[model samples]
Target: MSLRTLMLICALALPAWAHAAAPKPLYRDPVMDGAADVSIVFDKGRREWVMFYTNRRATQKDPDPADVAWVHATPIGMATSKDGLAWRYGGLAKFPAQCTGQTLWAPELYQEGGVYHMWLTVVPGVFHRWGEPGATARIVHLTSKDLKAWACGDTPDLGSDRVIDASVAKVGDRYRLWYKDERRGSRIVAVESPDLVHWRPLGDGPVVDMAAEGPKVFRFKDRWWMVADAWKGLIVLRSDDAKTWTLQESRLLEQPGRQPTDTAKGQHPDVVVNGGRAFLYYFVHQSNEPQAKADPYYGQRTVIQVAEIKEDGGVLSVDREAPVEQGLVAPK
Candidate 1:
């Protein structure tokens, strides 16, 4: 081969390695922007993608602090589409009765033994304004043997404090539940449950703790990836044994957005693998306000987005396309 030929080959390969190509956004939920905490469910039977999330009638830190208890949030909302690209809002799903105005948050729906199991943040006091000091936020899960009639079962007590945004993933035979509890600093903690209701603490209660919140997990390259948001930025940690994990980088990815409407402060890192490609769906809260002021991290409320997840062994960031999508969160 000629030296010139070799030089030409090197030049052609430069673009592929120059900077990893960003993944494409498949869908962005309008509700969380008005929509919050969106989850994506792929209906294999119908070959469709179902999007579910919380449609807040008002935010936690609304203009009126009293609205926190008064503004009745629309119950857990749902939308469906043939592809993840198009979504038609399906309105609210079943809300836990007796908990008025408690439009469910963190409605994570996953298939368990041919049934759909949903675990969500149930702030009962906010719904009723009971003013129950510690009984503010809780993680209550339910199961639907047929996706129709549901039954609430005994789950773990996230402490009466404020615990929300629960993400559960099945790693082989055991179940892993990740949630944010300021009860222990705004970090993600993991709990193990054999029956999916009762849980056992794995690794001193929190397997991964950061100055962040909203933890979700996805499996790729035959390994478990734990994604969480912290003051530093959005980080990804990998685990093979389910209990012990490794942080790929202190800062795995960062979303730069300057405006209140643009993608900033990425949270709720959700990933969807489709058509031999992977999409990372992250919730971007407009970072215009102090990070503390931002409910989830430091933005406006929370908006759902879809992004492409790059698989290059140890590094990945969101590839935002126009009208960018952060990725998939059946529990988003």
Candidate 2:
């Protein structure tokens, strides 16, 4: 069947989504929701790719537990793809039973020194809570040699009220982190570490005027560039030192009329440069369902997509198949 035909059949077969949201079509296959933002990486040995994101609910069974309270319970989940097209859900990448199943939000996975490391915004309970204040929010992470045996690692303290949405990139021998620093009043900040274990702030922040959340950094065509999702669909910025950045573009890759709350919220993008293709992975909400009188974020799920960039500066953008409501795409 053709891709559109397959999608039509898939839509026909899909159940009436209960919440107030519908998932926007992002990547092909492995239905992408609006809550799970993805990061992609290539596996040379396996000849495939991997994507990591926040899981939220487990298998849609037992529900979110927070359904009673109407909040987002985001745990970490993963997905894998062979040709960057068809994907399969791997489910629950790594969770700490200690957090009591609370949530692992905004995770960024990167291969550092032949090892795969993932860091996420972690909370303290088995269920989800909102507006918990700063002191409780911390960045949780994991490190693995094989990507299969994902062992929980140290929790880095960036801020308390809102320590969330972390992005990692390797610049030379050192690996740098671009994350939201709540202490600085919700701005995109950069920090560097010789060892991924201990990180120190590089100084103030990369963006001072705007609420710079979900900062993703990568080098395209020899120049360092950054992507973030705030009020629009994937904002772009560039910096020579990872400190001072200039806005290149905002809402550049848009899927119009998707979400009521965020009409152009195709943000939280992470890019992986492989074979001259910089796959910029991002997520958004599809608001096409009946409005709920109760929870506003109820229909909110994650949809993963990619915008390709070439070494010679060619931009290629494509939306993949949607994931099962909040289902994640793991690594192959």
Candidate 3:
């Protein structure tokens, strides 16, 4: 072939090379190998994506009781990525000594007033199974300037004995927090604060119906969106006033074509919106489902996944089976 024709052929093959070289659709914790209840925030100072999650011990098999082991004490897992998809485990978060070895649940990361704030669910008594009579859970506020070197604060009393999965968002001049009140049938409820220290209940009823947890709220476009883990799938709600909400008819996490067979429901979703593009981040347990049983690390182990959120005729949807690239891509 002539040199010019060869150059054209090479140019034609470039697209094929790019297509075949697309990054694999997977993200996992290399250290503990168990990542759940994931939350992501951009680190502008570090110029990368930082993920904080529940770092469960994947290799720790359940003892005779089975229930207690799964709920054992854990630290908040940390990972960093240049792009949001491929991750490198940065190790567990280093909190105050009091929080060491305590079961740290969903971590809600928010930045305000030049400080990085984290609302973490702290559960006492690791030996007791979840929902045990003596086990107590609370949400504590933490602050870090660099997402490292955290300062712990007292747990805010939300008029509940058992609360977990705290998510917060700032609207106008006030801050709003939504969390699961286990004292009230594990339903998701909301409270507001002007300074994020003292919170008052929004109303007498739960913001979301019973049987859901991990309430996350974010502002995208012109409306506010809230998502909760409903055990079966993710329950979605939208609000214009940030108080009254209407549930979306379709559940997000129960789509049938999930890879690795998401037998268990997707829990604790944190939505990251950038430049009018939204990406939903959540984790799925690697159960003994048909697609996961073949892997040696099945059961108890969980991996994080991200999906692009799209709106069609005012309805939002995600295809869990769609491949995610290594770097974050915002929709045009």
Global lDDT of each candidate = 0.62, 0.60, 0.77
Looking at model 3, the pairs that clash are none
How well is each residue in 1-332 modelled by candidate 1, as lDDT tens digits?
Answer: 99999989988886332433223222334544446566677655555576777665533455544334432344676777654554666656764474323446767778755677777777653453433445556777777654445777665765536777788887778898888876786667778778787787766756665556667787777777877767456777888866687876645346555433444655656666655566666655555546535454223355565656776766665545444333232322
Lowest lDDT sum, 10 consecutive residues, model 1, at 17-26
Any runs in candidate 1 off by more than 4 Å, and if so which? 1-33, 44-46, 58-74, 98-103, 127-135, 145-148, 158-161, 250-253, 257-261, 286-302, 321-332
Q: Cα RMSD to native, each candidate?
A: 8.1, 8.7, 3.8
- Model 1 has an lDDT value of 0.62
**Which portions of model 2 miss their true places by more than 4 Å?**
1-24, 27-35, 57-71, 96-101, 126-130, 133-135, 159-161, 254-264, 289-298, 309-332
> Which scores higher on TM-score, 2 or 3?
3
Give the residue spans of candidate 3 off by over 4 A: 1-25, 99-101, 256-258, 261-264, 289-297, 329-332
Q: What is the per-residue lDDT of model 2 for residues 131-209, given as tens digits with 9 covering 90 to 100?
A: 4433356777787776667677877756445577888877778878878866666778877888887888877544646
* TM-score for each candidate, following the candidate numbering: 0.73, 0.72, 0.87
lDDT of 3: 0.77
| Clashes (candidate 2) | 37
In angstroms, the error of model 3 at 1 is: 14
Question: Pairing residues by index, what is the TM-score of model 3?
Answer: 0.87
